[model samples]
Target chain A: SQQGEEDPQALSIQEGENATMNCSYKTSINNLQWYRQNSGRGLVHLILIRSNEREKHSGRLRVTLDTSKKSSSLLITASRAADTASYFCATPRGKLIFGQGTTLQVKP
Target chain B: EPEVTQTPSHQVTQMGQEVILRCVPISNHLYFYWYRQILGQKVEFLVSFYNNEISEKSEIFDDQFSVERPDGSNFTLKIRSTKLEDSAMYFCASSEDSPNGYTFGSGTRLTVV
Candidate 1:
């Protein structure tokens, strides 16, 4: 499968703590995107990093990409209870293939 | 911000029956895609439509599957004969430019009994 693989299938942290998720894909990509999904809901786009860039930040979220390694990581700083959700990294080939996802639980 | 909308948020159907999931993608977007996630599995790409034609489709989108714009505002996915294994949350997404970002709908939960 050309799908990306995410590490630490799950993570738990206290409120105000930071949470990080990583993704590795086997093939070259045009861009990588991160999404967050609450239980039984659709995914919300978080951030997108191009092949040329190494890192990007949006609000409390930060994303980093390493093209040479074909891996990417997402960081949510000062995570809140509301940030508890499954996060997925999508790497684009002909179509976007998602990782198994990392389920993050923020304890309040 | 404009969001994609899907009708019949949840649908229950019998095996072998035809099921159609409808999506109204964000207006002005040029690319549309369909994806499905099983109860505990990763989201799998089903197909992508552009320029009134299927730009790319995964093997999962076999002969049993078909897509159509139907009218100016709606996009539809038709499963000719549904199977029990087809039960999953189906998501419809649209993006102004691809490999960039995407906006997704709440999703239609398909339950094939």
Candidate 2:
């Protein structure tokens, strides 16, 4: 299926703390993308890291890809209460296969 | 920033009835996809469309399911006969290419009664 599995199914942290979530997949991928979904809403694209790139960053989000390990991680620095959402990693084959996702709660 | 737009934010239909979820992907995007998420469950892929035809689909996209790009900008998903399990939030997304980031619509909550 090439679906990514995310670690720490749920996480809770105080505002201003960093939150890190990891994802592992079974097959080779063209690129890995991170998406955040607010409760009952649609997914919002976070970042995309190509297989050849080891790391990429967008604003407060940093994503690292380890092709050898077949895993990736997303780090959000100084998370705000608004950061509370479910995060998913997707591997786009013909269609995008998403992970189960990590639910984050950033308390203010 | 352009966004994917979905109509009829919520729809309630009786079992065995047909339902058509509509979306208008961002203009100039080539890849369009449909995904669904049941309450408290993971998002699942259903189908992908490109160049006016389906490029790929999941097992869940059965014969009862179909997609169409009736015009230059609108995409639609039709379920011939919806079941109770068909109740979910249907999301439409589009990407410029296979490796690009996707823009998703707010979704249409389909309630099959």
Candidate 3:
């Protein structure tokens, strides 16, 4: 399976705290993207980091990619209760292959 | 903001029956894709469509699965014969460029009995 593996299957943090999730993939990739899913809802694109780039930031979200390590990390600064969701990392080869995802919980 | 739209948010069907999941991708986007997540499993790619033809497909998309853009706006996935294992959340996504970020629809939850 070319699917990426996300570390720390579940995370809990208080409001105003930062939440971080890591993803590791097995093969070379063109780009890696992070998405958030709230409960039964569909995925929302958060950010995308290319293999050639090391880091990118969008709003309160920060993403880092390490091609040498075949891994990427997503950080949410000062997370809010609304930020609670399942976060997935996807690597697009021919089609996007998604990780099992990290479920995040932010307590208000 | 433009978004991918899918119809019939949830459907309950019997095994061996045929089911068609429909989606309307963002206008001007040339790439379309279908993916499914079975309960708690990771999302798995089913197929990708471009230029009105399938560009790539996963092993899971066997003879039973087919994708078609019958018109200019509608992209559909037809399952010839649904199985109990076919119960999953099907998501439709589209991208203007390959390997770029894609906008995904809310998804259709199919419950096969």
Report the C-alpha lDDT of model 1 over A26-58, residue by residue, as the tens digit: 887888999999999999999999999999999
Tell me which residue pairs clash in candidate 1: none
What C-alpha lDDT does candidate 1 achieve relative to the native structure?
0.93
Best by DockQ: 3
Model 3 spans with C-alpha error above 4 angstroms: none
lDDT winner between 1 and 2, please give it: 2
CAPRI quality of model 1: high
The TM-score that candidate 1 achieves is: 0.97
**Best-to-worst ranking by DockQ:** 3, 1, 2
lDDT of 2 by residue, B56-107 (tens): 8989999999999998989999999999999999999998976587899999
Model 3, residue B104: distance off in Å is 0.4
Q: Which stretches of model 2 miss by more than 4 angstroms? A: none
The 10-residue segment of model 1 chain B with minimum total lDDT is B94-103
The 10 consecutive residues of candidate 3 chain B with the worst lDDT sum are: B94-103
* DockQ, computed on Cα atoms, for candidate 1: 0.81
